[model samples]
Target chain A: MRKSIAIDMDNVIVDIETNWINWYEKEFGVKIEREELLGKPEDEAFPDPAAALSLIYKTGFFRHAPIIEGAQEALLKLQEHYDIFIVSAAMEFPNSLPEKYDWLNEHFPFISWKNIVFCGDKRIIDTDYLIDDHLKNLDFCKGTPILFTASHNVNVTKHKRVNNWNEALALLGLH
Target chain B: MRKSIAIDMDNVIVDIETNWINWYEKEFGVKIEREELLGKPEDEAFPDPAAALSLIYKTGFFRHAPIIEGAQEALLKLQEHYDIFIVSAAMEFPNSLPEKYDWLNEHFPFISWKNIVFCGDKRIIDTDYLIDDHLKNLDFCKGTPILFTASHNVNVTKHKRVNNWNEALALLGLH
Candidate 1:
């Protein structure tokens, strides 16, 4: 049986840190060092985090978000060995649904629509492995949790961590 | 607190029974009366159920599927009193994701994208009420199950059956 892998989209496959930081800096007119966000929840990393995060809920943010370095290549390689599902807590931003779908279609065309899951809660997902950037999602996963490194999650140490796509591929034995 | 109602998409909202019957006749060149399909799972209703059902997996079938009579009106009215979520087993048909999303956008624009759940298994859903045509979905639901009468499920007597949208509205005291 092919092992199934449920991958989170925002910080895992897509590079939200770079885009968010740039957007936040330009929008807020405040310089935010990347390290300032380390080990902090996104809301706590900045003043008025709700307003800052709401920018992501806008129409074009997710559609134009940059793909993390090596994510496309690693995911394509991973698809050959496992059932790769792009699971995201997209309901938080209702507009992200079509944007995320279009983003995946553009960047990860090889992934079938069946493998894409847009849901609110991660606890409901049952898979062989879950790769997520948030501890909240990983904490409830029924499968082995591989923490994908993100600025907000760097301090989390409960699960095995993958700093980059190469590390993820190696950990999954895809390397 | 507004009660959450998770509504199934296929027969409960979109009229798949009529569309499937029409498509089955054109593709298979065999007339299948609606009554003949009663009480039978979709696949078992035909000689080559796999092939018959595969037609539904095609691109246009779901996008072009007609809405169940009164579903739109009923849902609009229900939205006034309850939190409505459109939950469908869309992952089973890979091609239906975008189609279903677009269909909802066109027909049920009042429903926010946050309420749309495209998932494989319905067991994970947490809601107050589940309105679905499939007994398999309702059997595992954590809430009151309202069986929406579909041709395949007309014989089902296990749950509170609502034969039409008017009946459904009346049962929920929305009428």
Candidate 2:
């Protein structure tokens, strides 16, 4: 049995637009400045892309996206074999870890206030299996590495990748 | 079965004191001038702690930390179920990720090339779990957090913590 399982919430479990809206509003005051979204340049996407990227995990944008399709089922099932945890890098600190934990608790019984780790580095959160959407994370991860795919990952053409939960399960032989 | 794992080298899996000594002489001007190891000030680990940190990761100081007891065994067993990755935060450039990978490969097969993530925040590495001596990193994780014990961590007194492979396994119920 897998001892532990970790799931990424955004993109893998939640949509992207949720965070984009929040970032736009908070960083650039773009909610009142809606025209900024219609970019002559992508500056409004992240008012300061470089700084935003560095602080992305600490941003208010996390916890905003809706869980991806089938992520709930996969996470719930994975919980049966592994101690489950949500390893995420959010620039935003929720009012409390319990707030996010409670939100997740509504869906999955195995996930709880104790298992949740909210930090800038998802790697520090220990688990046997960490499902993530970002490729760079896989660079040093040991185990069955699963990549949640997206349009931006197009350039990552090779190197054994996956787009969804079904593919990830099959790839890992969990299917 | 665990599918993903994250490991830390310096001060986590191995001791880097001597290695740092070698680096001090080579990169910086004089040894005692380096100061920190000689019991200098809090921030003066070197002429530039950032430079020292960068050189260590770059020049193999990180690759040479004598393996902590049970480190090899713990990592090997964890690898059976998880895709292990090295999510490290070094101040170095392109050398950060690859150098860490090399150190792992040279020292332990458990930490192979396929799984290694070199980054600064680590929270951004996007793993389900990350291991580090920094309680701050432990405090900042976004998942099922595991705080591995170190000499300095003894004073950290509270919060869920672990000392070695056995304790870590117990934390995840793998033991």
Candidate 3:
């Protein structure tokens, strides 16, 4: 049997930061630089933290998040070597589950519905490798935790890190 | 720390059989006896197997499933002694995710969103006890597999069985 890998959806596969930054600029009419927001959590990055954070709770947030660059190609390659599961901490946003499903269906068509997992907590997932952006999710993982880089998680350095899809591919020996 | 328990949604906490039976009767304009469904898979028990199976994939099927008798009370009591997680294999029906969430919210309000897991497979779930209706799910579980009785699973006697919520409570020593 092939080894299994549990991948986080939000920052790992879907680039929520870019969409959020764009949404924040459009909503508040204030252009924010990606560099200026580096190392800051989504809420703390903006002038109005509450308003910026509220975007995630909105209905279409996950649906509109752009696919991370090189993710589709890397995942397709990884699929042949390992069992891939898209695990998202989405139960917190009850309305986002369907949107996340539709988002995965539309963007990552190669990923089967059987490989998707939407839950409130990530502690229950048992796999060989867990590639996630959030430390909270990875901290509890029994598998090898690979930290996927995001602006908010830039300061986190204890785990093995992957700055991009290419790095993740190379790190996993897929390259 | 309290031992964790993973509970199935359909045929366990939610009485999907009664709703499905009622749906079949209303759709086909025929009175069907619940006794006739004993030891038979839902699809095989009805006149139109395909039609009966189609009811599950239809929208609102899971959303409207009636709560099992004594499930809420029993679950609440169990919650004090065990860490309860409602794990459902729902990814096959992508659109049903939000509906299932809403259904849990409506009926099992005590089950926090943090404890719900909607996934395609149960193999990845790590818990101390898995109380599920399907043998396929239980067979893969690493924990104590407690089979929750359903019409389709009536013949299966491979695991610890609980015919209803009351029996389940007693079996778990909550009664």
Candidate 4:
């Protein structure tokens, strides 16, 4: 069986969180409170964090997101070996799942929409490389977690911190 | 027979002109002469429009391009009836085509590198609905040319203008 890879859409595929944070915060009437969202346990993070993720995604903020530095190059290298699955927790919220799916279809056509899984909790899904930024979701990975660095992560430094797609590839030993 | 629709990438798929105007004025010391670029014949309006387009596309400008307002809804709807080809004159220039294609893949996965048609003059390709912003390329299509609206083209009333995608659907009768 081939190793499957789970990649996050927001901060990893593109810089959605950083760029849309201000606009979304203004519109939603609440702060993202990155530390709190990432620090909470998965059970507590549910509904609120997922709600926040879906809320931001519903505003159509990720439509024009800039791809993370070296994202395409990194994905290209990764695609050669592993089964690239863009399993996004971004669109798991209600009312906008289909819209987010359409958006995903527009951005990345290489993976069939079938491979693009959406769920509130990522730990339930199994994959080889879980490339994501949130700490709450990283705990359930049966495989190694490739941590994507962001502005709002806690001080737990056990996992690999990748600055860009290039660093991600290097950490995966694909470079 | 499938009616091939060869659309432009820069403005057709995403708004590349507005993004470049800002870059050109600051870096190249050239204010965007839109009237000069679109109105006059390509030879007269843009003595080196091809070169200029190549320069902008190479700068990774396509990575952040907003899908042209009408083109987005229009392209998705259009994808159903015809074999849509992204025939961009911008990527025909040297050293920029690969990155430009990659950029398209990042934003609009519906358009793969293989389906994209590159030409100095779109007149060479065969297509029905040539949804384009540039007037020069419109000459290539024997079918109806659905004009995507833009800032520089506020005054050109000769061609049909579409600000939203639904109007594009109506124009192509894809609705």
Candidate 5:
């Protein structure tokens, strides 16, 4: 049987961190320094984290997020060997449902709608491997968890970490 | 921590079996006998199971599905004691996404949009209790699995069974 792989959307597939930073700078007139954000919560790293974070949850935000470097090529290659599923914690923002759907349809049209999951909690996902940036999502995975490095999750080291799509593809033996 | 409950939407909460049967009759001009369907796959019981099943995947089918008797009341009452999430394997039918969302908004408006999950595989769901009609869904659950009795699952005996919403309520100590 082909091993099932569940890939997260935010920092793993799409560069939401860059989008957040750019949106914050454009909206709040404050360019947050990366060093200050290291090892700090979003609310602590910025003047108004809630407002800044809320911008991404609005309609059309996910549709506009730039794909992570090498993600498209790596995912296309990975799709040949594994049953890839895009598992996103999208219920927190109801507006994200259609937007995420459209985004996936545009970028990863090869991924069937049956492989896309819009969920609230990651604990319920059962797969052979999970590639995600958040420890909270990886902590309870029944399968092997590979941490995709992100700015906020830089200090988390409980699981095997992959810094980029090349590393992730190699870790999964896709390369 | 509050115990979390994951509820299946199809036959458990909404009467999809009945709707399918009714639709099959209307579309094919052939009335299917309930006995012919017992313990058999839909394909075995129908002239064209693919076509019959495909009707339910259309955009409007889910929006018009009748709620399982007492489901709305039981879920509402159960909501007072536990954190409830609707975990539906809806990604199999892409058109069902917006329809299911709209149906929940109209009927079970009390369920926050945050609590609704649309996914393909059920194995990824993690919760304290899963009330579902399929043994396939319950077989891999980490939590207590309460088999919500449906005609197709009537012969399944591996798990504790509840014939109706009242029985489900009683089993969960809500009665």
Candidate 6:
């Protein structure tokens, strides 16, 4: 059987930072620089954290997130070598469930519904490898953990790191 | 740390059979007896399988499914001993995602969103025990499988069986 890899949806494949930042700027009428967000979580990066984080509760926030550059091509190549499951922690925002499903359907049509998981705790997931941006998830994972680079997780060095989709493909020997 | 248990939604905690049967009777003007549905899957149990199954796609089908008898009490008791996760194969019906979350919130209020998982495949779940009505889920489970009795699965005997919530509690050594 091919080894299975659980890939996180947010910062790993979907460029949620860009979408969230744009929404934050549009709603708050402030164009925050990327440097301000570096080394800090999304909530803490903003002057008013709760107000900025509230944008996630908006209906189309998750659905409209831009796909990471080269994610589609990298994922297609990864699919040939491994069983890929797009795992997202969407239970916290119940509204994001269907939106995430539609987003995946529209963008990654190659991934079947059977391979998508909207879950709460990633610790319950058992796979050969887990690719994620959160150290909390990787700390408890039973499989090999590959840290996907995100502004919030730049300082975390406990797991193998991949700076981008290209680096991920290279690390996994896909290219 | 507590040993974790993964519990199925349909036919286990939420009685989908009664809801679907009631829906079919209302739509087709023909009542389906419980005996007729015995030993048969939901779709195959009906005359027009497609039409009957289509009710699942209807807006509020999953949202209104009645909770199983003694489930709330038994689950509450079980929660004290084991980490309980409500795992459901909900990705197939994208519309059912939020509805199922609402249903669980209304009926099983004690279960936090942190313990709920909506996914395509049960094989990815890692827990100490899985209480489910389907054998396909059990077949791939890496943990102990406890088969919950359902009309369609009465003939299945490959796993340890519990006829009702009372039996399930007794088998688990709970009062």
Q: Give the deviation of candidate 2 from the true structure as CA RMSD.
A: 15.1
Q: Model 2, range B108-174, lDDT digits (tens) per residue?
A: 7545433544334454344567677776566776655677765446556555678777887666556
Q: How far does residue A161 in candidate 5 sit from its true spot (Å)?
A: 2.0
B39 in model 5: Cα distance from truth in Å? 8.8
Model 5: CA > 4 A from native: A25-37, A43-47, B1-5, B16-65, B76-85, B105-115, B126-130, B134-162, B170-175
* lDDT tens readout by residue for model 6, A38-151: 889766988789988899999899999999999999999999999999989999899889899999998899999889999998899999999999988999999999999999
lDDT of 3 by residue, B67-108 (tens): 999889989999999999999999987767888889999988
Tens digit of per-residue lDDT, candidate 5, span B117-163? 89877776778999988877899787899998777777887899999
Instruction: Give the Cα error of residue B149 in candidate 2, in Å.
Output: 2.2
Lowest-scoring 10 consecutive residues by lDDT in candidate 1 chain B?
B119-128
Interface DockQ of each model: 0.25, 0.03, 0.89, 0.01, 0.47, 0.91
lDDT of 2 at A33: 38
Per-candidate count of clashing residue pairs (backbone under 3 Å):
0, 47, 0, 0, 5, 0
- Tens digits of per-residue lDDT for model 5, A1-175: 7898999998888888777777888877889766767766555666787888778666667888888999999989998888899999887776777788888888899898778889877776778999998888899898999999887778886999999999998898878
Evaluation by DockQ, superior candidate among 2 and 3:
3
- Among all windows of 10 consecutive residues in model 4 chain B, the one with the lowest summed lDDT is B90-99
Query: What is the lDDT for B73 in model 3?
Result: 92
What tens-digit string does per-residue lDDT give for candidate 1 at B17-62?
Answer: 8888888888878877888888888779777889787887676999
State in Å the error of residue B53, model 4: 43
- Residue lDDT tens for model 4, A46-157: 3355555554545456555566778777777788888777765542333334444556556665665445654445544456778888877777675688888765554568
DockQ category of candidate 3: high
C-alpha RMSD values across all candidates: 6.7, 15.1, 1.3, 14.9, 4.4, 0.9
TM-score for all models, in order of appearance:
0.65, 0.42, 0.97, 0.41, 0.74, 0.98
- Span of 10 residues, lowest total lDDT, candidate 3 chain A: A34-43
TM-score: model 2 vs. ground truth:
0.42
* lDDT (Cα, 0-100) at B58 in candidate 2: 60
